[model samples]
Target: MDIEKYIRNIADFPKQGIQFKDITPLLANKDASAQCLENLLQLVGGQKIDKVVGIESRGFFFGTLLAQKLNAGFIPIRKPGKLPYTTLKESYQLEYGMDALEIHEDAIKKGDRVLLHDDVLATGGTASAACSLIEKLGGEIVQCNFLIELKGLNGIQKLKKHIVNSLLQY
Candidate 1:
């Protein structure tokens, strides 16, 4: 399936000099969404996943879908106090300052095989922070999955320790 064709590119969106690759167009089409999900699942390569840790909002979309398809528990890693529980947080450095993400302390058990997910891999700060939160809870990261990866940004450098895969790269 040509999933890239379904992606909507918006120039200078959400800020200046940023080209956003929107997935809503792909999400809107049933077959395209299903195909993309299948492609993402293929990235797992049949490995057993105990939990799927999805980042914030966009990650929640296919994150839950991947969990359901894998028959694993879905764990949401949110920003700040979005989760109503005893949470563990990990902060990361941004271009100007710092940002953080939180996960429920009990979200993952020791030795659990986890698949961390996000909609896009930008500067790698967000994903790296999410990885820290997973590690703090003792979950072994099986793979870091993303729908789109912007290679020009060099996000993969920060995630050098893990297996990274994406359906589409820009």
Candidate 2:
């Protein structure tokens, strides 16, 4: 599948001077979404992922699917106060602004292998912060994967220490 075609570009979404890569089109198409999920699985290439962590909103879409496909625990890295239980917070910067993500203190067991998923890697702040929370809880990150990565933003620079995979780059 030409997954890139499913990505719709929106000008000045949420704010000006930012081009948003919308995945709603892809999500609406069962075939493309499945193909993208298969591609994500292929990126793992048989790594044993004990847990799959998805970022707050958009990540939840494919994150749940990935967890089901892998038979791994699905964890949500949500915005502050979103999680009901005791949580650890990590603050970070975004391309447009600043935000924080929270993860349950017990989300991952010590030494658990984690796969982090997000819809897009724009500034790396969200992913980097989420990674900190995971490690603070003693979870070893296996990989950080995304549905789309904005290459010009160089989000990978902040995630240089870990394996980062993406199905589509813009």
Query: Which predicted model would earn the best lDDT?
Result: 2
What are the per-model C-alpha RMSD values against the true structure? Answer: 1.3, 0.7
The residue pairs found clashing in candidate 1 are: none
Which digits, one per residue and each the tens of the lDDT, describe model 1 over residues 72-94? 99999998989999999888875
User: Which digits, one per residue and each the tens of the lDDT, describe model 2 over residues 1-170?
Assistant: 89899999999997999999999999999999999999999988899999999998999999999999999999999999888999999999999899999999999999999999999999899999999999999999999999999999999999999999998887
Candidate 2 wrong stretches, greater than 4 Å? none
lDDT of 1 at 18: 82
CA lDDT of each candidate? 0.92, 0.94
- Model 1 scores a C-alpha lDDT of 0.92
Compared to the true structure, candidate 2 yields what TM-score?
0.98
